[model samples]
Target: MNIGFIGLGIMGSGMANNLLKSGFNMYVFNRTREKAKELEDNGAKFCSTPKELAEKSDLIFMMLTDVRACRAVSEDKDGFLESLSKGKVVVNFSTVHPNYSLELREMVKEKEAMFLESPVLGSKIPAQKGELVILSAGDKEAFEICTDAFEKISKKAMYLGDVPKASYVKVVNNEAFATSLTAYLEGLAFAKKIGLDPEMVFNILNSGALSNPYFEFKVKKVLNDDFETHFSFENMKKDLGYALSVADEFKCYCPTLAAVNEIFKKGLNKHAKEDMSAVYKIFDE
Candidate 1:
């Protein structure tokens, strides 16, 4: 299959590499051309722009960071919408608002193109091993056609039946993850504040019922105070914002999500340029 990928950040880069390793013909584009150079060395062709990438590929996978960037690339002048032909599929792998995904679905269908919202669940390490889960929704025919490529980059591709539903599921998953991470942070922080040895507290958490792999992995970064931006604080803030919007739209009373959204904002305000793991600092208060 001719696969075109845009965005070359931590997760996107790993996913694209997996596609190349799986022997797909990969065409990659990044706003920053230097980012595409690494993939070029791996036999993935590089494109100067999204329009160029769209013209040459049957499927275009977008792993951009935000709704604004996704919209710009897919809807702008001479954009993917302009260049995409009938029967092509645009697979979105970014975490975006459901409403935006719905709009994009319509946008692509207008061009006789198919839109698949396939926001992934799992970060850098999982993506590297091709163990990331893809939650997707779109036209059934398009979904079937793209399943092979999806399987190449993911441990599983779950079809959620339609566009907005998959996006809703992704937002809820992020909300739950944020909620659990916050509670985990609070427990660990309180243990330290009460005169317990920090290392022992962490060791116990890592060894006990609360010892999830996420805690095992992220606690080290939290303890070492290394907030390098694998995923930025601003990104978490955006995710929380979108999740809360979904809750509000459905008249769902999600106090925990609401609280986490506030805490995410505070973390972003304090560490606007830091990694999302810095959300722990708010719990430290």
Candidate 2:
């Protein structure tokens, strides 16, 4: 398949490399040309802009940062909107608000191309290994056509039936995850405050019912003070904010989660660019 990928940050960079390794004809573009250079050296074609990438490929994947960036890349001057046409497929892997995903679904459909919202659940390592959980939703035919590509990028690709539904599921999923992480942080912090060895606390948690692979993996990082950009605090803040918006839209009562969202924001100024594990620094501070 003729595939194009934009947004070559940590997640996108790994995904693009996997696509190239999987033997797809990959066309890659990043706002910073340097990010695309590695892909170019690996046999992926480089494009100067999203529009140019769109012009050259049948399928385009975008993993931008947030709603604003997603919209800007697909609709701005010299963006992807100008070149989108029939028979094209645009798969969005970014974590964006459901309402924005709905808007883009229509925008691409108007251009006679199909749009799929497939927010992934994994960070740098999982993305690099193609072990992501892809929650995908869109037109059935488009979903079917994307099956091969999806297999190349994720361990599991769920067809969620429609655009905003998959987006909604993603938001809800992150709500649970952010809240869970916050709960972990609170417990760990409380342990240290009470003079319990934090390592011993983690050891107990790892051996108990509360433990899971994800929790253990993250907590081990926390114990070691290793917050080396698996997923940024600012990005977690963005997802929590969107998740809260979804809760509010549905008239759901989530005061604990609401509080957790504010807690995540506490890291924005200091640990904004670091992994979400850096939120632990907030407790220490």
Highest lDDT: give the candidate number. 2
lDDT of 2 at 45: 92
lDDT, candidates in the order shown: 0.86, 0.89
The numbered model that scores best in TM-score is 2
Candidate 1 structure lDDT = 0.86
| Model 2's TM-score against the true structure | 0.98
Candidate 1 residue lDDT tens string, 153-233: 888989889778899999988888878887887777888889887678889877878878876778788898877876678
Give the poorly placed runs of model 1, Cα more than 4 Å off: none
> Model 2: per-residue lDDT, tens digit, 209-235?
887898888888888888899888899
> Model 1 — which ten-residue stretch has the worst lDDT?
264-273
Candidate 2 Cα outliers beyond 4 Å, as residue runs = none
